[model samples]
Target: MFKCFYPDQYLDSTYQINFEQLYAKGFRGILFDIDNTLVPHGAPADERAKALFARLKELGFGYCFVSNNKKDRVEPFCEETGGCCVYKAGKPSPKGYQKAMELLGTERKNTLFIGDQLFTDIYGAKKAGLFCILVKPIHPKEEIQIVLKRYLEKIVLFFYQKQKKEGNS
Candidate 1:
């Protein structure tokens, strides 16, 4: 029942992801979550994020930022990082993911989604049939609603881990 929330891969941070390997594996595009996924909540893109985007571009990967935040918050960050973005993206709804794929000019099978939240990110990506990667949130500080979701996520994660251990993944 919780299968849609399970990430294809989990990592400590976006830095740990091997973009080169993903490129070789036939992933041509990526959709990224901004807050907590690329930086601390409400934080701007940093040097590290810039470099990562540059590397992705060099590797011929198309990418876009898909965030639930308003345009004001997402636009400036994407401007700084040189990325296209769709703000106010009501994730877990396929519209946002579809918009992102359109921006990347990629089909679902060739696209991947990376984010920190299982419910909003992983579930949405899975529903859209895109490969999903979950990264640990960059900071602990979050809105009360998200904090509560994190707690619920832990329970789902426990079962996901167990399933993996049993070779059911």
Candidate 2:
């Protein structure tokens, strides 16, 4: 069961993930979270964020942005990234993942979903049967809701780590 969350399926900071490495991993497509993952919550896209969008395009990867936020909240970034956006996506419900795939017109076997939260991003990806990559939030000050969730995430991660170690042994 622990094998469901493979170590290689995660990325530390979004910036640290090599686009080439993701392609090598059999991921021909990517679905990304807009707020807090690409930019600080409520902030516009930074230079690095814009570069990442361009980089994905250059790499020939099919990508989309699936955000739990409303249209007003996600429109700018979606425009900046030039990726299809699913507003009010209600992630952890698999709606966003399904919509993303529909927009990309691809299969889950060649796709990856990237985000900064376990409850939403990770869980949604798992439920959709796609590879999930968790990245650290772009800024700690961005979302109060995420800050609250992190407290619970620590406990869950602790148990997951222990379980993984025991299973490997």
Candidate 3:
């Protein structure tokens, strides 16, 4: 029942993801969520994010930022990173994900989505038939709405972990 919220993979952070390995695994495009995924919510693009984008390009990966935030929040970051972006993305809805794939010029099977939220990022990407990766949030502090969502996310994650353990066993 909570399958829609399950991430295909979970990693410690976006920095920890092996882009080269994903490239080898046939994922040609990557769609990233900005707030808390690439940086803390409302934070600017950091050196690490810039370096990661450089590495992704070096590895022949196509990438774009897909964010639910308004243009004011997303534009400067994209400009700093030189990445295409879809702002106010309305995630968990397939429209933004499809638009991201179109921007990357990749088919669904070849696209991957990475974000810190399951309900928004993973669910939306999976719904769009793209592989999903969930990363730990960059900071524990969040807006009240996100804080509330995190409480519910913990319950979903509990079941997700149980299922993973059972599958392995």
C-alpha lDDT values of all predictions: 0.93, 0.79, 0.91
lDDT of 1 by residue, 67-135 (tens): 999999999999998868999999988789899899889999899999999999999899989999999
TM-scores vs. true structure, each candidate: 0.98, 0.89, 0.97
Clashes of each: 0, 0, 0
TM-score of 1: 0.98
Taking the tens digit of each residue's C-alpha lDDT, what string does model 3 give over 81-132? 8768999899989899899888889999899999999889999998999889
CA lDDT, candidate 3, residue 155: 96
Candidate with the greatest TM-score versus the true structure: 1
Tens digit of lDDT per residue, candidate 2, span 1-169? 4343333355568888888987887778898887777778888878898898888889988888888888987887778768778888898888888988999988889988889887888888888888777777777785677889988777666667677578752
Error of 3 at 34 (Å): 0.5
Can you give the lDDT of residue 140 in candidate 3?
88
In terms of lDDT, model 1 sits at 0.93
Q: Who is ahead in TM-score, 1 or 3?
A: 1
